[model samples]
Target: MATTKTVDLILDAGMALVAGAGPDGASVRAIADRAGVSAPAVQHHFRAKESLLHGIYARAVDCHLEVTAAALLPVVLPHAERVAEPARQGVIVEMATSVMQEWLREEGRATLTSVILHLLVHAVRDASYGDLASRWLAGTVTAFESVGVAGTGDAQFLVELLIGAALVSAPGRFRCENDILNRELFRSACGARDWDGGFWLERYRTRHERTRPDSDPSGEGEGLYARLLDVCVALTAEVGADALSYRKIAARAKVAPSSVLYHFPNRTGLLMALYREVHRRFMLAAGTEEVEPRAQAAPAAGLFAKLIVDEMAGEAPLFLTSCELFLASWREMELAPDALFMRLERGKMHGVPQLSPSERQRAHLHSIWSLGLALTQYSHASSHRSRDVELRLRDGMRFLDD
Candidate 1:
């Protein structure tokens, strides 16, 4: 029989492997070997591969939640009590930042990294977990709202940033010229205008509404390219970017599959084009006009953050596809520089600024942090709390001040 200590040893070994090679590498025999136990002994303790994975997943979630709750509890309690002192609010943020930073240091990283990666790599299997995370975050936000001390970022948004920061910053994940991408995304974001924040809604009748075949006997007309892109966007939302296929896009577009190839050439090309369109729309909706190349950063960043989160909540599937592509870029060597370049071009088209290296780095961090916010809010279907969402964005825009 495996002792409690021995079980700990087995679970630890399994986590180490998962972190290094992801979920695919954590085979039972491999776990057994790593744990220095016989295969049957490993099975005796965990009867199935899935059972073993669940063990690790639960363990990681518990550890993550415990640390999170500890840090958030103080702030939440005061908020729920309606403590509304400005001084207290400042103190609470400082204390919360300190506690959260502690987790980013040393052994805390090791403890959290495996779990975060596990969550990301096997995100599909654990759809329900995201809901739990959403509820946990909302509670934290509500706690703060109840208190008079208003926080710029809600608990859920803050933790979302933590998970994202932990994942990419973890040594195991690939790092790229994110600062460059950040500048472009920020610059492009600044180029547009007109912000309406909502979730899953239809726009008021546009001047050029397309006519469906039943209505006009023509077809969904005047927006074939736009319609096709919308289909791609919707497809990404439904099946995720990983499963996005040309055949699927064609079927949804009601175009020939070969026609998709005619326009896109390949999967990468299709995705790149689709994201460009999506990003363009994002910029237009997020911005009104460009400022003096971030002569001021916070105001501009705030606008973009608010816009991004609004869209994320309403159009999560699109953002999830974007997330999928973002991860894909990290894994595909040939995709590099192109992914960053395309983003830069988009920004230039919308007119992004020429940022200093340091400034660009700050902007990149801002983009990453924002993505984390979106990932948390939209990736799961949970109750929407608009106040908390705004708090998350305001807090994240702080990175722009650097």
Candidate 2:
């Protein structure tokens, strides 16, 4: 007789496994074993592995909302009518910002976020799982509305940006850019007017770093090396990083398994190579110079937004694969440092002309928001995909004209 307690225990065990090792770790039998229940019990509760995965995410999301209750109360609780709109909005924005900051800084919440993202990455390919992901995002917007923030484009992007930051950027780095990031976040979250771009421009100029990936050694034949990378990228985009095996790559490339290993000795090396290759493809596809640290001249403000649209239209597999890798970096500590650099490097500021400081900042900001948007929307129907990308591009371009 499995009670509600039995269901909770099963969900707890599933989340722990998935969070630590991704979707592959949370097998039905394994979850049941961890929960000290028979495999039949897990089946009885969730009915299938897919349902169990969905259940894990639903539980995690509910727990997140539960914990967030205390922080949101400053805005959630009713206020006096005498309070000015600006003052009340300020409290709401402040509370939202604090809650997001905790998502970055707090260990328990961060782990839960990782679990959510892990399942989300799965949802990109799994239609059944995508329903839960969609509901979770919509519920977030509704949650924001309850706290007085309107469901404007900026507010939507702010939610995406916070989710993206949790996916890729480290907590310390999020704190480092807190002031600049929050200025932008507050504008979007609370509908505040835009401010000076000088602080962001100066920070962009001084703080951005460039480190090139290791060049492929020619001893193993550069052609073979490049071929291996192409296969890895395609497979990763089709399947996922977790499902990638050396045998799989070799089979696709029609090369010996040892040859694949000879060129790339480990999973980390292969992933790093894949990152550089993906970066090169993005630069070339955007009509920017691939080898340079910055573009020849700054691209137009909405250029990256257009670039995102194009990628979704044509190169969706690659785009989603990049999203998977970025999120994976957050969960895998050894990969975090280089992956962080790779992510920040994608939003270089030096090459564009007459670019306003705000535009430059928005360029970087939109890049993050795009990651979140693509993750959540890519699994939808084709018509919705086009509409969402267009809306995202429109919302992203709004700051450029200022």
- Identify the leading candidate in terms of lDDT: 2
lDDT of 1 by residue, 1-402 (tens): 548877887888877666554555679989889999888888888998877876776666566556655655565554554444444535444434543444444465455544553455344335655644454445545543444444434444444545444433332222233322222333322221221221001111122123222121223343565666677776665445545577777887788887666655677656666667666666666653542235354565556545655554124534455555544443344665444443333222235556444343344444456556765654355455455555556555543231
Q: Candidate 1: which stretches are off by over 4 Å? A: 1-56, 59-127, 131-225, 290-306, 309-317, 330-334, 339-349, 352-363, 379-382, 398-402
Residue-level error in angstroms, candidate 2, position 369: 1.1
Q: Which portions of model 2 miss their true places by more than 4 Å?
A: 68-70, 75-93, 105-107, 170-210, 214-220, 289-306, 309-316, 349-360, 382-384, 399-402
**CA displacement after TM-score superposition, residue 6 of candidate 2 (Å):** 1.4
TM-score of 1: 0.52
Tell me the number of clashing residue pairs for each predicted model.
11, 3
RMSD of each: 11.7, 4.7
Candidate 2 lands at a TM-score of: 0.80
